[model samples]
Target chain A: MKSIRIVSDFNSNQLIRLWKNINNNIKFSNNDFNQVYQEFANYKNRNDITVFWTNAQRVIPSFNDLLEYKDFDENVCYDEVRNYAISLKTYHKEKSNISIVPSWHLPLDFKGIESQNWKFNYGPKFIISKMNMIMSEIFSQDENIYLIDSEIWFNDKIDLDINKLWYTVKVPYSNNIFLNSITTFNSILDGVLGKSKKIIILDLDNTLWGGIIGDDGIDGIKLGGHDYLGEAFLDFQKELKKLKRRGILLAICSKNNEKIAIDTIKNHSEMILKKDDFVTWRINWDDKATNIQSLMNEINLGLDSAVFLDDNPLERDLVKKALNEIEVPDLPLDPTNYSSFLRSLNYFESSTLTKEDFARSKMYKENIKRIESKKPNFSFDRWIKSTESKLKCIKINNSNIERAIQLFNKTNQMNLSTRRLNREEFLEWIKEKNRFVFLYSLKDRFGDLGIIGLVSLEINLKDAMIVDFILSCRAMGRNIENMILSHIRKFLIEKEKDSITAVYKKTSRNSPILDMLKKSDFEEITKYTFKRNNISIYFKSDPNIKFEEINDKN
Target chain B: MTIKQIVYKCLDEINLSLSDGDKLNKSKDELLIGDGGKLDSLALMIFLTDIEKNLKNHLNIDINVLDDKLMSNSNGPYKTIGTFIEYYEKKNEIN
Candidate 1:
């Protein structure tokens, strides 16, 4: 199980109350102390800032009782505290893992402006801003930290990432640091916040209007634009369209004749949503979950990320109770209040925002491009040759080891064995005198594929066990795997290590890797075990395979 | 108008007249998702949408009633028109 440490100022009771809601599995510590060193060990070992229950609870140590840099600066207590904290940090030197800033410090921006009034009895906003600044600093330093700015977390009201915003917003949080890691809660929050939902599985009849679209006929249905109830629904549809524009994949999963709903979405221009807005359309009597399943297969997103918006509470409850992971937001009784009511759903918050985030749903819209592009119009081999895809095959160096380990843990597909190794475990394995770690950075014509693949292995000089060989799904279908294996084989030939072995581990989210094994055509020693120790040193270069040098200098 | 009248009105809108016996049986937990108890999320979405419009028309009560606690409680107030009426009455009484 992945580990995270929560650092919060919640009294034991307050922490326990929210503990179950946030994470049932996370380990939490409720320690209140004036000394930084006393609270530094666990915070230094695990992931940063799990949960901080700073309900006006954080107090900066006496400004007078701190340290200075020079030795034996006995006169100034402030000097002593500062010096000691610095010494502890320097002695630890970049080992500070999970971190929290004391409430007293100002969040000094890059422009050097003090963000909040530091001298005043600053509320939770002080810590929240401090956390944001620190995260901004840490994320810049390394890519490992996926900073979810707490200010943006709860409607810009309670910046959970910042503690002082809580005092201002009156939002008390039980210190759950693993909120972003909780995918269901996060997805729901993301959905409600209008962050990322590809498919909006909607209902028919009363959902779209007052009566069933089939039973009531086109004019009979109560939609927002034309009739009284129709106006309210029109408001609802307008809100749905806004979400759709933000790259939310809209789909129809209703129990209605396809023609009527189609006519309404298509011909009904006064209607808020058009037929083209939804990437996938499923309007049949099939079970919503089954419809959802087909939609998920069609769109290729985890059900956990999709939001099912229906008018019937029963249908919502069925999906919620059945697939607890998929977010089934409670539809408000008042269609008129939907615009504001949807505002309150927690899953709508954007946790990690990158430029690529906005394009996922459009990519869903362009899934035809995604599929058709997968099969190159220029023909597979020609496309592979035309792009002149260069593979930068590099041996693991000290500077890249941490990133390599991260890729090892995170890369799902093309991961031969899915062997996840933390830094310590990886370092120990590397020092074993028999292991090799290789990271591949692929760059094609479109853009740079950043550190797309990695393979961690252990060979007894004569034979090797491929512990992990995973590549990102982004780099698939590029004949990339063929080139990666080619490099490994050539390296093995140089070392005279014969009979290389590999394993394929199965996971629910990773179906692409199964294809990787089949494509490589490995000799199956057993059901899931495959081995290929020898490749012809003179193996005819299938003109389909294009290879190039990946020297560190380049 | 009392929540009971509103509940009956809601039942009327959905075209399902709740009997006094069925009303009594309508506690929060047994509300199905799609049928009488279970509302297809679409129907629940539509049902809530219509209910809001009806509430505004008759009761003039502008309340935001669609959310996790409203529908997800094992004994959710949103479960039945009756339970919802009780919740509305209680919430208004507090207000």
Candidate 2:
């Protein structure tokens, strides 16, 4: 079982209870209250995730001096925060485990001089804000050290009854704040575990716009301009566009005339989402559940990766019952609340935003183009050759570590082991004797599919085992799998290894990997385990693709 | 609603946050504090704070459930759900 060691300044029993309520699989270790640095130094479990939660005044005595309106050097407070951050980073580098430090915030009702609080550097609020900024900047440099924005849990009203709770029970915040914090924490955990939703399937008629597109037509739909509902719909579309920009694939699953809907998306002045913004759409009169399944199949993504949004209750219920894996959120009755409600769900939370994430929708769109360009009678090999695909193999380093971790966790279908690891865990694993990882970025005439494959190897004596063989579904079925195996064989040969072995671990979605292994000329020594004695003769390079090896100088 | 109903409703609301095994029974005879109680010291604090907030919102009457008398009394206000309801009814009447 995965363990979480929570070390906090205040009593953390309530937080532990709430977190346990959220997830039972995790084993929690709540350290003694107000023993922040002691627990940090005492932490030895390299696999367990450590959470360092502290109240500003409790941890830093200089912060209390500032809070009391006494003369204090701001640099001292900053130095303390920096010390904590640097210590956490050093501990993380040593332990090679994840550490979460929540950004400190003053209480909502902190009574400071109203105008001077934000304007002056000496103000308590100002110092705390600056401290949080310093913490963000320093913590961001380390992948394992996560600095969560704790301020998001608070609001205009004081969430703490300082008089009753602080003195009586060492818990400062209200139960509501704790509840909200747990929810955000759960989202963060989901993001860290690579379980965040990737796609949003939207209904166009009443969902994307204010009115039904079938009956109202393009001109009659309430989209933008002076009307409140129109502006709301427009804003909602803008929110969806922003999600698309951040790599969440948008698709339409509406029962509508495809031509008319496409026309409205293209021609409508108020529509923020254009026709090309969607990677794929199933705008048909068929059952929406079937359409959604078909769209997922076409896009090569799982049903669990999608969040369906539809204003029609009947359609929502139908989709929810038919496609249980797909998350169908109940759209609010009012169109004005749609954008905020969607934002509140936090389905698209990502731990690290990479260049590939920004270009994800565009990459999928290009994949769709590649699919459409292929003739119905064209041979698979010829079609792949026609695309002029190129694979660049690069050793994993600091620059590509985040994206490498993302692919390691997200790819399921073509994965051999399906082992999930955070950046620190991965780095630590590779630091062991005779372990290496190769990341492959695929590019065709269509587009650059950024780092879609990862191959991990473990060498023992003259034999080498493929620890992890992961390829993104987007790059599959294009001779990329054959090329990856060939590349591995060549590397092992260069390393003077006698044989290369791969064991296919069976998962619900990983049958595709088994098929690839069978076709790649590996003799089945046992069930699910394949081995090749003559690595040079067994694996052949795909003539359709060109391979380049990139060395990381840094 | 009666005072008994209000207290029971608050208990039901608090049960939403509690784990399934730790959930408070709606029955008045159910133990609420000390041994055999669903709440520990921290949970009791949350329960009492929630009760005070609910009473203020629903009845517009503010009462401190954690008063000096209640803390010092051998027979505290929260011994069982029935005792808590009885104490709350008397407190509401006094208010």
lDDT of each: 0.55, 0.80
Report the Cα lDDT for candidate 1. Answer: 0.55
- In terms of lDDT, which candidate is strongest? 2
Docking class for model 2 is: acceptable
Task: List, residue by residue over B1-95, the lDDT tens digit for candidate 1.
Answer: 65556555544433331222333233444463324664444334434544554565577777765555666664556655556767778987887
Candidate 1 TM-score versus the reference: 0.40
Per-residue accuracy of model 2 over A156-245 as CA lDDT, tens digit each? 253554457777788877767877877877777777888899999999977899765644567888999999999999999999998998
Give the winner by TM-score: 2
Of candidate 1 chain A, the 10-residue stretch with the lowest lDDT total is: A369-378
- Evaluate model 2: give its lDDT: 0.80
**Can you tell me which runs of candidate 1 are displaced by over 4 Å?**
A10-13, A20-22, A34-43, A52-198, A215-220, A226-231, A317-325, A348-350, A368-554, B1-95
Scoring the B chain of model 2 against the true B chain gives a TM-score of: 0.80
Local lDDT at A122 for model 2 = 85
For candidate 1, write residues A1-554 as lDDT tens digits. 32334334433333332434445554445445333345554434443333332321132232211111123222242333344434334323344333332222222111222464342323224333443444345344443233443332233221233232232222233123323224433443334334564567777666666665543456666775546677877877777776666556678788655766788677665677777777776775434655666666677667777788886654565466556668888877777776666655554444445556567556777773322112111233544565556677777777777779777776543566667789898788789777777888877664576777887777775877777777764465456776777777777778788777777787533445655566574677887787785654443344654456555543
